[model samples]
Target: MELLAWGNTELDSSWSVTEKSNCSYIRIYHLTSGSICYSDTAMSCALDTEAVYILPSHAPFTMKPAPGTDTHCTWLHMNIYPVLVKELLSIPYTQKQALLFSLMRCIMEEAYPPAASLSHCAEIFIQDLYQMGCLEKPDPAFSPVLDYLCVHFSEDISISDTARQFGYTPEHFIRKFKKETGSTPYQFLTGYRMGKCCELLRKGYPVSSVCALTGYHDIKTFDRAFKKYHGRTASEYQKYFKKIYP
Candidate 1:
């Protein structure tokens, strides 16, 4: 995970925004004073002061401060894996304040390289959420399949074969996988492969090698899929990151 942005800010009633679609990064908000309402197509909720709100990536919602009130908040924007939890989570602002501020301090302090510290802090926060049972848990029945995919994503494996290997028929497996993961098996496989492709690319691997390593046989096909996933061609993505990091 990477910290994209962090800050404390005060917003007045005049501040309101509608996000008509999912955002690319997760949002973490620690409300210090006043309140805000978050609404989506399905539900609406008010976030009170002294509470922490976690808005998972790819969740579409709108937020506005209470009328005539000023809301003080510390917020973080992070580039992390799409969290399985889709709903906005409101947790009490207790011991977690230390963790959030620690993350901020990781970026603010120049005593040492911050990359490892930042990741460590973020990982702890995420793990805390999991231990608190705030995140969704995958079905135990599908654990083997998930584990298999992690190890064999580079291999060409058919959905039917995978399902049978785990004692599930193709149709039932597809349904269960979709229900548990919010995506079809093929979609999940493609996403996992694309993630690996990104990791390899960021490590300076050539696009051609990344394609084969991530299970693609044809360069053009890999290019198309990578572009669709990342909104940039493989070579362009590598160049873009190089420019930023160099």
Candidate 2:
């Protein structure tokens, strides 16, 4: 995981925001004073000052502060795996606040926070969430394929061959994978690779090395895909993180 941006803002009663959808990063907000009504297609609720709200990637949402009241907030934007969003949301409010505040302090206290320290905190928080039984177990039949991809993502993968190895036909594998994971195998692999690319970049890996580490042999292809996936070239992404934390 990587911290993309952080802000502490005070907004008046007139403040509101509407987004057709959030971008690639996850958004987290803690209101220090007042409240806001948050609504998405699935649910609507008042976000109170004592709680934290984590809006996952690509979710459509809106926020409007209570009438006639000013609001104070601390917010963070981060790059993390989308699969973990569900689990993160399931964590209890107090636990979420504790973990998030620690993360905020790590970034705010230092002129130049170490990237590895941030990554380590994120990893530990994720592990604690899992230990709390927030994650849903994967379907037994699909677990093998998921495990394979997790271990072999840095290798050149062939969908057809992978299906055969796992006792599935390519057509059936595509269908079943989509049914189980809400994404096709290729989409999942690419998403995983791009996420790893970001993590490696934040760890100070050079672009050329990160490309090879993420299994893209062709530099040109990696460059194009990186730009498309992240809205910035690999070098630019690396430089952005360095400028913020180096």
Candidate 3:
């Protein structure tokens, strides 16, 4: 997932937007209040309160405020390849959802310092949509990159090597990567490793395994980084969340 833009938007009776072609990026709108009606040359979808709306790239459409209501929503603009627009279009607007608030929180967190993993948030967003049966395709170009990182993060991988695997030069890769995901490779790796550590620890994996699993050859280094990133030592963090975990 390549993040182009993300934030909140409030639309009133006067609000309207029209897209010509897929417009290079897809937009996902998680409506928190009010309503909206979407239309295209083919058909329309009446989007009501607390719904997720997906506008796929290259699919021309227009969105307008629904009758007599204000609309409040958070939106994410991204490039998700092989988008299942038809599948997304057919989903019920008020379907039960998951990860909406958490994903938003991550987006907000990445907007500030110590900010990491906006890219991961995007991946989670995709995962949620896919889980909800909204997004059907998993052929996005970035999937391989993410999969590789997750499976091999324990190895001493470097940016240039990772970039080359993706068929890009070092300098160009950084620019392209940052543009697509809002994070550098190293930053993403740190966040990814920390996340993996958190998960493994939650699942009763010992810290030593997590150290190797996350590619930290040194226990002390891993401990310090874990503390800094999560604001607690691994033991403490695990203990804190363990009660809530079940």
Candidate 4:
């Protein structure tokens, strides 16, 4: 499932893993006095008043609470952008921003309506993401960088080179880039690389060849990073997604 929308309304005294990874659903569960363990080998972190989690698509995981556990909380799921997540982390630790969570609720409410407007909800969500420091408008020069990245994702490009080409010092360019894109040049480049890697893998490219084509130094590192970001090794991901490529 695409995980279009989801949230918890009334608090559940306790709930177990009825189903997991059937949908890309991440949720917030408020625990009254006990903790809920979510995962067998994966690790999760608490977000706010409740423990928040993001379940990667197709990744197997489990959730169970301690005996007598009682909790009240809301859960949400979204197709999030990596840049947006980076923006949220860039905010001051003390800041409590619920832009993403709030947007999910609004989208869900309208998702089933006779005249649901998901695109409108997306536009509003982008605004919320910007307001919450979870997204930012790219600088005018950023388009060049984006264009270059699109064409040369397989090349090893550095921020310093990109900065020089744009007539800005590395420090200045890095700051302006982050201000506009909510991600450092390195982070954005990696995201681009990962995206291309996914496409190449799904197109039936050999793992080692994909590593070379994607500018990864070696297959080992590429495999590790692929699993880290996509929750599946390149081979496994390709096995599932490759047939879908036309």
**C-alpha lDDT score of every prediction, in listed order:** 0.72, 0.71, 0.66, 0.54
Clashing pairs in 2: none
- Candidate achieving higher lDDT, 2 or 3: 2
Best by lDDT: 1
Rank order (by TM-score, best first): 2, 1, 4, 3
Error of 3 at 94 (Å): 8.9
Kindly list the per-residue Cα lDDT of model 2 for residues 1-246, writing each as its tens digit: 566556667877777766563344566777778888878778787777666667655456788897767788777666654343431252345876576665766566677766556556555655665687643444777888987996799898999999999999999999988666546677677877887887788779988999999999988999999898777899998887785556
Regions of candidate 2 where Cα sits further than 4 Å from its true position: 1-28, 33-39, 57-92, 99-103, 217-220, 243-246
lDDT of 2 at 91: 38
Q: lDDT by residue for model 4 over 115-204, one digit each (tens)?
A: 134334444544554686544345555687767765777777877988898889999988877666555677666666776776677567
- TM-score attained by model 4: 0.49
Could you give the C-alpha RMSD of every candidate to the true structure, in order shown? 5.0, 4.5, 11.9, 10.2
Model 3: per-residue lDDT, tens digit, 176-228? Answer: 75555445667556766776777788677888888888889888999999987
Count of backbone collisions in candidate 2 = 0
Most accurate candidate by TM-score: 2
Per-prediction TM-score: 0.69, 0.70, 0.47, 0.49
